[model samples]
Target: AIDTVKSSAATWTEPAQSTTAAATASVDAAASSATDFMENANAAETAAASEAEASALSIGDYITAGKTRSQIQGYGGYTDIGGTILTIESITDQTITFSIVQYSDSGYAADTVSAKQITAQWVKNTAAFEFCDDTLDGKGYGTLSYENGTIHIETRSNTNHPTKLVLNEDLVGT
Candidate 1:
């Protein structure tokens, strides 16, 4: 019994492994992956920006401004957006050239800015193309939706008139 209980208690030292290098490597890899994630996100942002094309205002279509005031007056108040309707003279993949026609100036100093081209960018949404106001200098004037060869204009107005204008048919209904 004495021998079984040995004079000196059996001492055991647990084996251990150094994890410093492994841990450091794992942290470094994670940091690298984070950088890659940021780069990918930036690339996706760029792609989305470049994805905008022109809208569906054909040459000769008429577009009556929702309300000719602030934004519709053109950059630097140079254009009064004169009178009532705008006659689209030409349309490209990125711009709409139009001329104000039909009536006299409403209030602002009369200025019939002819051949005025405005940025008309849009992104395809399934079967419709929605107006891309990303170039509005952080201001959203309204929304334009084009589908089935017709233009649907809706101002983000919370008062008076809402959800207005339909190009082809149902012009009176909207």
Candidate 2:
């Protein structure tokens, strides 16, 4: 009778031990899977953060004040009017404000003088081009041209003129 009782106990204990071992393995597997998922999520977040920083604009990217006429022409425009960047104020993620002067020759064949307040906005499809929809005198819009290192700001025409203001990075602060 004693031997039979001992044998019964041994059988019961062995099954319980096997069940405990299986449960432990299952728990370990679940924990490892959860850890892997967390690691992957962290990696994705880090990559996204890096991409945003890369897209941020810098001050130098907007405009360089006081560029000479010859230097401006190198970027592909005629320096018919000599101008220097007077000031750069209020820079944002999408806009910048600056001042420029040009020697105009429309009045007397000699270079006439003019100053313009330039507001530039970031355009998505066009990089480095900011459309100036306003003028120094609070005009709603103006004819802005950037060609041959010269930027021309003229009165905004209402005659459905195709002379839209196109901004180029090369024309900024020149």
Pick by TM-score: which candidate is best? 2
- Per-candidate clashes, comma-separated: 0, 5
TM-score of 1: 0.26
lDDT of 1 at 115: 22
Q: Please report, as a residue range, the 10-residue window in candidate 1 with the lowest summed lDDT.
A: 165-174
TM-score for each predicted model, relative to the true structure: 0.26, 0.41
Model 1 lDDT per residue over 131-154, tens place: 222222121234444554444443
Candidate 2, poorest ten consecutive residues by summed lDDT: 125-134
Candidate lDDT (C-alpha), each: 0.40, 0.45
**37-78, model 2: which lDDT tens digit per residue?**
999999999999887655543233222235554433233364
Q: Candidate 2: global Cα-lDDT? A: 0.45
Top-lDDT candidate index: 2
Which ranges of candidate 2 are over 4 A from the true structure? 60-90, 97-119, 123-174
lDDT of 1 at 8: 34
